[model samples]
Target: MRLEEIVIDNLRKLRRLISVRRMDDAEEAACKIVKYIFEDAPVLGLDLDGTIDEAPEFFRLLSRIWPGRVVIITCRLDEDKARADADKFGVFYDELVTVRKLEDKAEAIEQTGVTVYVDDQDECLMDIPMDVTVLKIRNEGNFTDGKWLYSGRTGKQIC
Candidate 1:
């Protein structure tokens, strides 16, 4: 189902802890997320984790599909960076929010009326409310065409 809004919880996505690849690829891959929330009037909230690649091409893709409409939630409680990043992403938040803990993700998302949230960490995902769409990130191996890896409770995907 197409979510009313898309929420990205991490800037690195998964490349930060998982397999070491070029930063550009991960950023571009993140860009694809914009397609899910294309155009209309719905909003997009990307939870910036204070990473350099917070705004990527995937965001631009969303903007192209949907003009001037997006929201951003920052975990660091850093308003300045969030605003600047919002400008960089081209998907400006109708309003910017900041919090001290990741656990606040669900509460924060709920307040904004978000339906889908994309996050790399399972912990952060758990923190959010269940009503929202939780698009948790998986390692590249999980997305492999042939052999798929199931990341059990330990966060280690067994091939």
Candidate 2:
């Protein structure tokens, strides 16, 4: 049988960039994703790098839709650091495993049995197993109302 599970990645990388202020499209994209999860058309995955705040709302929403199927992947470089950050963010997850190397992405996803890996960095996920499709989160373009809208906007809308 073909796989249809979701595996998210690249949150840590996206979050660490100090220059970025907010993602306007995040909520919109998330809303669409939430709808998709409820349909069960394709399973969803959530990956975090411990940079963004623990999104209780997103977790709660996904939980209501997918229940026990959502998987969260992350890397902390240090187990103690991971636990400390998990506690700090209150990230209650089915699997909150820490990874040592970047190349372990495939093995980790294999363990979760997820089909697609949604990451922001294409380079890191490029070498994963063929069965695992890697989707890079784009900065903008054709996404409609995306988080990138507010990237460089000012208080006054230029007419």
Error of 1 at 37 (Å): 14
Model 1 earns a TM-score of 0.53
Q: Which regions of candidate 1 fall more than 4 Å away from where they truly are?
A: 1-43, 50-55, 67-69, 137-159
Task: Give lDDT tens digits, candidate 2, residues 19-67.
Answer: 3645543433333334434443443445565222335454545434453
Candidate 2 lDDT for residue 19: 34
C-alpha lDDT of candidate 1 relative to the true structure: 0.55
Q: How far is candidate 2 from the true structure (C-alpha RMSD, Å)?
A: 15.8
Q: Rate the local accuracy (lDDT) of all candidates.
A: 0.55, 0.49
Q: Clash totals for all models, in order? A: 1, 3
Prediction 2 TM-score vs. true:
0.45
Maximum-lDDT candidate:
1
